[model samples]
Target: MLAHARQLLDGSVPLPAGTARVAAAMLIRRALEELAAEWSGCPEATTRSQLVIAARRLPPTEAERACLAWFALSEACHHHAYRLPPNPVELVRWLSVVGGLPAPHP
Candidate 1:
């Protein structure tokens, strides 16, 4: 699911507005589903929170930034309790995926 999300993010598959967020929500939902199936009992609140955060951090293309910013802001308003992921590796990957980083990994 994450791989599919990545593909969509990378433009391998075109996604319309709300598609990325929906995809991410579905992936996290499935993870929670698997945990519930095993009686592992995932924290729905925390997972939902993180997925929201990830969706917000998604980069917008230059042409789409204005529209995406509005969408992102609306999503933020509803999910105000969510916290962004803090792990360094995850942060780096998120920035890279969002096109906030330089090319070729120099």
Candidate 2:
């Protein structure tokens, strides 16, 4: 599974970004499912929290940064048009770093 994750990071799979996101989500979901089965008494919330943290650690590449910027702007516009709360600007900054738009500050 780790190998598969690494492959995904390598960007050699030639899939669309949305497709890749779905695949990545599925992989994480499966791991959570397995972990839940293995640790019968563990809270699902804990497992989900840990998964989110781990997923956040998977830094994006330069190409991904462009995608994220476009995605964020599109989402913001959509929400604004509908009178929904705007997405956090922190998300844009975080995605910028993760997508390799810029190096994270020390």
**Candidate number achieving the greatest TM-score relative to the actual structure:** 2
Worst 10 contiguous positions by lDDT, candidate 2? 97-106
Top lDDT model? 2
Backbone clash total for model 1 is 0
Off by over 4 Å in 2: 41-106
Query: By how many angstroms RMSD does model 1 differ from the true structure?
Result: 13.8
Query: In candidate 2, which residue pairs get closer than 3 Å at backbone N, Cα or C atoms, i.e. clash?
Result: none
Q: Please, what are the lDDT tens digits per residue for candidate 1 over residues 16-104?
A: 63454445444433433332222223345443343343334434352233234333433433433455422334322432333322121
Question: Compared with the true structure, what per-residue lDDT tens digits does model 2 show for residues 1-106?
Answer: 4345334434677776545444443443343334333333334555444334433443444434433443443443332343543323433343333333332222
Q: For candidate 1, what is the TM-score?
A: 0.31
TM-score to native of every candidate shown:
0.31, 0.36
